[model samples]
Target: MELLDLLLHPVRLRIVNAMFGGRIRTTTDLCRRLPDVPKTTVYRHVGLLADAGILEVADERRVHGAVERHYRLSRERARIDAEAAASMTLDDHRHGFAAAMAALLAEFNGYLDREGADPTADMVSYRQFPIWLDAQEQAEAVAALTPLLRGLAEKKPRPGRRQLLLSTILFPMGEVEEGE
Candidate 1:
């Protein structure tokens, strides 16, 4: 399957998110994290991701006569690159956006459901800022943020560090009307 088709499913998106930030997780770990999804379904989707090269086996071990595989996200394969994005139709963008929103909602709900959940304590912020930028400025802005985000992604887990989800969406709202 194409990368867009493979990554746009709600379950698969969640799986990808779960595997983000240099984390290596097993099928059991994924199943536990996504209890709403059936164990069989999680395993099946993980298989599909692995088959599609979006996931790789980081390690494997035998446990009670069963081989437990640890999977990690192949960031290169999980991306919707410029060429693929350029080829996506309007409906594809709509479906992709819907799937992404669904995944975000699920993750937010899961976080809220956890014990001792405190959005304020956790420094949770979901604010939207409207900025006016010309095409060149917009490109420059993205160029600036890309490396900072990548640096954060490259960081390994350490004590006293929390794994935080950062989602970014950038799109123009169109030019101002003449009257306005």
Candidate 2:
């Protein structure tokens, strides 16, 4: 099964994003963090992810009469291969992008909803531009950006350091010209 397809759901994506800080969380913790999601719905998606091998069962314990299981990302970062994505229809791309955008917007709304969301404590920004680049430069740009992402994916924060989310989206600015 394509984990990408499974993660396309906003709830699971949000849960995965919530776990990014080298932190593991149980169902209850997820419920608290994802107040907009019904607890049962969260559990159903979490179970699906675990079954898909995208989420690992990190820890477990009994909470009252029930067992609580904590979960963490099975892979440090999400990846999809060309072959996997090649078969998707235009509708799939449209729906997937819309889902991702909605998830992003929800996170921004979450920050705003945080207690004591001080301007000094938060900021968000984005940039876009039309540009020209040769194939080599385009490849180089992706190469240059990969390490920063790998660092975010692999770096385990120390006790004193706060966890941070480093999200980036990059692609060629249109088809590359042989000479530009």
Candidate 3:
């Protein structure tokens, strides 16, 4: 399946999100992380991700006669290539965007639901900025941000370090209405 098609499913998207931060997780770990999702559903989606090469087995061990596999995200295979992204139609983009937004909402809610949740202490930031930029400026902005984002992704999981989800959406704004 195409990367877009594979990831657009809400459960699949969440599964992928859970695999980030260079953490190796087993199927049991995923079940704990996504308590709302059924255990069978999580197993099925993890199998699909593994079959698609997006999730690879990092290790395995036998526990009480059952072998449990530890999986990690293959970052290269988890993303849509430039060619595939370029081929996406408006409708395709719409569906992909909607899926992404839904996943983000679910993750945010999960965070808020946790005990001792404190947005201020945790440094959660969710604000939109309206900026006017020409085509050249827009291109420059993306060029500048791309490397920064990649650098953050390159960091591996470590003790005392937390995994934070950062989602960004950049689009041209339509005509503005009168305001103060």
Indicate the residue-level lDDT of 131 in model 2: 62
Q: What is the lDDT of residue 41 in candidate 3?
A: 94
Model 1, residue 92: displacement in angstroms? 1.0
Q: In model 2, where do residues sit more than 4 Å from their true spots?
A: 76-78, 171-180
**lDDT, residue 174, candidate 2:** 67
Any idea what lDDT model 1 has?
0.92
lDDT (Cα, tens digit) per residue for candidate 3, span 1-180: 777899888888999888987889999999999888899999999999999999999999999999999999998998888998999999999999999998888888989999999999999999999898878999999999999999998888888888899998999788655662
TM-score of each: 0.93, 0.82, 0.94
**Residue pairs in candidate 1 whose N, alpha carbon or C atoms collide under 3 angstroms:** none
Candidate maximizing lDDT: 1
Deviation from truth (RMSD, Å), model 1: 1.5
TM-score of 3: 0.94
lDDT scores of the candidates, listed in order: 0.92, 0.74, 0.91
Per-residue error for 118 in candidate 2, Å, reads: 3.1
